[model samples]
Target: MTRKEQTRLQVLNGVLEHQVTVDEAAQVLGLSERHLWRILAAYRKEGAAALAHGNRGRRPANAIPLGLRDRVVALTQKRYQGINHTHLTELLAEREGVVLSRPTVRRILVRAGLTSPRHRRPPQHRCRRQRMPQEGMLLQLDGSHHLWLEDRGPWLTLLLAVDDATGTAPYALFQDQEDTRGYLSLLQGVIERRGVPMAVYTDGHAVFQSRRAGRDETNRGGATQWSRALGELGVTQILAHSPEAKGRVERANGTFQDRLVSELRLAGASTLAEANQVLGDFLPRFNQRFGVPAAQPESAYRPMDSELDLGSVLCIKELRRVAKDNTVQYHGRSLQLFPSMERTSYAGARVEVQERLDGRLLVRHREQILTPQEAPALAADLRAQVAEGPVVVARPDPDPTDWNPPQRVKTPVIPGPLAGDSIWYEDPARKQVHRDLVLAGMERARYQGKRIGRPRVSERPEFEQQFTVVVERIGRGGLSRRQAARELGIGYATLKRLLDSQEKSCTKPATSLSLKPDTGEDY
Candidate 1:
């Protein structure tokens, strides 16, 4: 007898001999007291054999007949060869007139060895993260590149965003490629429909994180246009370190690759637009099937701010400084900003140019939208076409008598300009002052029969003193003293002492900071 049958027999015998109460026997056998009484009667009538299940050795009433099972196995090997259980189940019902559930078909095939049971490696234990308590707290975002239309069309990428709390997909779109405009369009739809999510979890793609090396976090800020738009909208973007880190979206991609591809295939969608139209019908059904309710009934999504201009925020923003001709250049295209109330001239002013998702360009300054027209292809001629006002042109060749060519003259100086005087210096202000001093020194030295040439850098006390002053000024302006020292060609300790003395003299009491040597004397 089986272990369960042996245990039942032991419990029944114990109750019969009075060694255990009926309640105790029922508890040990995990059966109700009423059920135990019936078993007790049966046990007394038929002995220990009564404890065996009645249907243990009998065929199930609902089981498929052996003949049907054999036919299914044969068809699986012949007609429906290589099809999966689910697919075979579909074909059997539709083509062969054999209506059987997927599990039933799988069992029949497995028993006949026509198909082996699917084997998988043991899953490694991972601590699964819990979903956010409220909807819209976090949305896992990703893109799945697959042949969504199967053999009917080209491969496409589905830009997807799934809410963490509810497992609801707020947005998904089929795009030719995963580009910035697709994401911008996706976000625009999401904000208009379900409001903006608090945060988005995405992978470390170039769209989210900077791929360029050597840029600090600050310099790398808003490196990608998508990220810049997100920053403007005040939405936090969290980039996952690995694919498994965003397992929700990664697993969702797998599901879409399996189910969405099939749905698109069945719908006979071959183009991007046709597939997107099918998604509208598919998403609602998908959510109904897979979406779960959030832990909290209240949504975490804050109502859209009244001042939130989604059109302005969900776009590609590029900072362009207006050229001297009152024009802004972006992506090889020059745009001329018309005169507005905000300013008559945009020349030399920074204006934000937004390449809207709809493929229109908008020029904005201080939240004021400026009317921009594509400047003529001849960018050099934009100033004359549309600028602050009407252009006043002088004839290319004016009357010879009216426009006389000016004459050039020379101004004499005490000494000719020095080589060091004309050379570009990092500190122009210091360079000018030193140049004047050198000229004056040269004038005075001529009287002493001394040569007028560049001073030796190491021996020039004035140059060293001037450099120290420049370094000290830079240090006071927030540059680290060591960095200032490196730029100024001085020792780090020397710069530190100079800065310390200057700071102490300026902010604190004018007291000397003396250092004590090992001999107990102040240096």
Candidate 2:
């Protein structure tokens, strides 16, 4: 029985004993004296047992059967094991046609040892803070870097915008990294969904904050491209001094990184698209659990500025003038503009030019917009004639034997002492051996001639004599190892072996190379 019903029975017991006056009992019970006396007379005539409620013995007509309850518990244990109570309840209702409230199903599963493991919640601290009065009044924008796809792919950044009051995720997208382009797209989506919010609260990321030019400047100045774009749309950009200043978006990012990862896994989302689709369905349910009513009824979102040019503002490019023939050149593509009857010359006039991310041309000359069209065959012929020059061929063909190998310049090799500097022997044969060895080593290092030495390392003075001959032969462009070996009149494998040994011994770190100023591409 309820506490009020139990108190009423105690009062009736006091009345039956006549220990307290009916007027005093009425005052204690907070009831009228007339009603208390009437109830006491009725109880005295009917006896104490008759005062019990008539509906106490009746069972609820909609009560679930014990057998069905046991079946649900068994199903939960067998099929829906490890699932959360809400999900388990859904699965039971959908798959087994056994509908039960989440709490009832949870109790049954717990009794049957089918309960999921309990997670320890962090300690809560009460603080005085106010959320926006309505949804769309303020939006918390942030990017979260997460391993959304587990080890299946590289890390991705989930850019999200959450409504401050209702916890509604109006916009969310996945990108490889957090960049200005990603935020532009997210902002575009937000504007499209619920119009412009009163203000956007975000951390002091470089993308949001303008860098100060000097120390004397009190205000954060030098408007960034992003800030300028937002300014044109009349959206106030608020930079938070600390993360706690923009706690809503920061906290939302944390919650999503934890719960959204699990949600995506449960939904079997492997790609960004699939994860986004599941997020659409998961956000409303998430909000219902966490959201609170706003302080006021109406939203503060203003209508989007009609004069805003979204495309031109979001893209990065400079304006250029079209030539006399109504054509602009960018990235080697000639964007031609056709003249209308009202216009005469198109020379020296500023036009809106945008290079889209996908490398498309959008040329706007006043209200007249023009896309590039392929020139007519006649026009193409004239242009080709004006642009092209004649090609020249050189005389060729020299006799095979007459093609003598280039003269091999013999250079001196400084040999190491055979036994601790005791003798400095000048053996040309040994020098030749070392030279052959070094060349053969270079050949192997160059991937068997698949990739030539791109000069990633500087020429070591220790191998100056050996490298000079090799560099000369390679610079000539037609000399081959076989020819070099033939010129030296040494066995091919012996020369190759010596070269390989020299390479193995001369392994130096790449940092050893000297960084010189660029002098064309001669080096």
Candidate 3:
């Protein structure tokens, strides 16, 4: 039995024993005397059994069936375990055929050991303030930084403006950081969507508020660039003392960080584009649940001014007229601005020259936006003539046959079987032999072009072969390997191997007839 019923039984017991008066028992238990007397009578008639209420055995008429309760719990555990009971309940009815209240889902979850863990914290202090009656009367603008893409990407700053009355987010955009450009672009979007609001509430960001000066102490009489733009459109800008002062957007940021992050995660929004697409559908549902009604029945937003030039107001530089000579000077460059159509004259005339944020030039005079026109052929020719400097001509070279190469002299060679052996010849004409023999001797002489005298005989292969054997013996006999290898162009090991192989072959004995050395006279 519940504590209340137990206490009622105890009060009845006190009344039955006559230990306390009915009025006293009733007063002690905070109940009517008649109610206490009724409890006492039921206890006297049915003993302790009557102390139980009649409704104890009665089942609730609208109670869900056990099977249905089990099914709902199973569905929640299987498909929506981590989802909140309220959202789960909605999903249950929508996705499945289960119709259950949020409280019923919560009860089922609790009984099934699925209650959400509660965090312990001290009591929070809250401030109470009334919002404006009309939706467009006040807009709270701020930026929130979060890991909007989970682990998929870097953190992004969300620049959002929420209506103070309806809590409706009319403008939201993702940026790399909260900067002046972000707010300027955000304001432009808000203006385009909902027209001009009555007033805007924001923190003291330099974009909306003057840092060096207060709202009433700016260079142009307390007006910032954004403030000036708003003033030009007759919109009021209210600067908040702190983040809490503009509590609407601040609180909205908190809600979005929690609910929106989950929403984005569930929708598989890994990029800014995907998040924006999902946000379009999520904002309406979120506003319906948390938003309050506006105080005024109608909106207070004003129509945008017709003659207001949006680009010029948003951009940093002021518009100026383009000078003649088809040129509009800015910063340092002398920009040449030409008219597309055939105009008789543009001298001493007003032409709007828009200096863009990225330092680009756009000239607009009257209602038409002027463009450059191509110069005529005659004008181009005149410009070329008036320009300075003389032209130089480059011609091709004369015929190749006109040039002659240097002459070269022929040399003669020695004769005999030794012709094959590379030998140096002193006078080639004197050593001339049979044409074929001379050719063969010429090959042996190893005639290298353009030498003053005969090349050293030691350069010949026959000289190197005999010199190598002698050098190897000299090395083992006394001299260093470097002296021996240098004469043969072979390393120490190669010379040593040659000597070893010669000794091995000599000891192996002669298998063929030995020939006598040539005794022919020198050629």
How many clashing residue pairs are found in candidate 3? 4
User: Which model scores highest in TM-score?
Assistant: 1
Question: What's the alpha carbon RMSD for model 1?
Answer: 22.2
In terms of lDDT, the poorest run of 10 residues in model 2 is 511-520
Sorted by lDDT (best first), the order is: 1, 3, 2
Runs of candidate 1 exceeding 4 Å displacement: 1-61, 65-100, 108-121, 213-222, 379-523
lDDT of 2 at 431: 49
Q: Which of the two candidates, 1 or 3, achieves a greater lDDT against the reference?
A: 1
Off by over 4 Å in 2: 1-127, 210-222, 305-317, 321-334, 340-346, 355-360, 365-523
Once model 1 is optimally superposed onto the true structure by TM-score, how far is the C-alpha of residue 71 displaced, in angstroms? 10
lDDT of 1 by residue, 273-377 (tens): 999999888788778878999999998776678877778877877677898878898887879888887688888887788877778899988778886997766
Task: Please provide, for model 2 over 142-163, each residue's C-alpha lDDT reduced to its tens digit, 9 standing for 90 to 100.
Answer: 8888888675556788898988
The better-scoring model by TM-score among 1 and 3 is 1
Candidate with better lDDT, 1 vs 2: 1
User: In angstroms, how far off is 255's CA in candidate 1?
Assistant: 1.0
lDDT of 2 at 204: 77
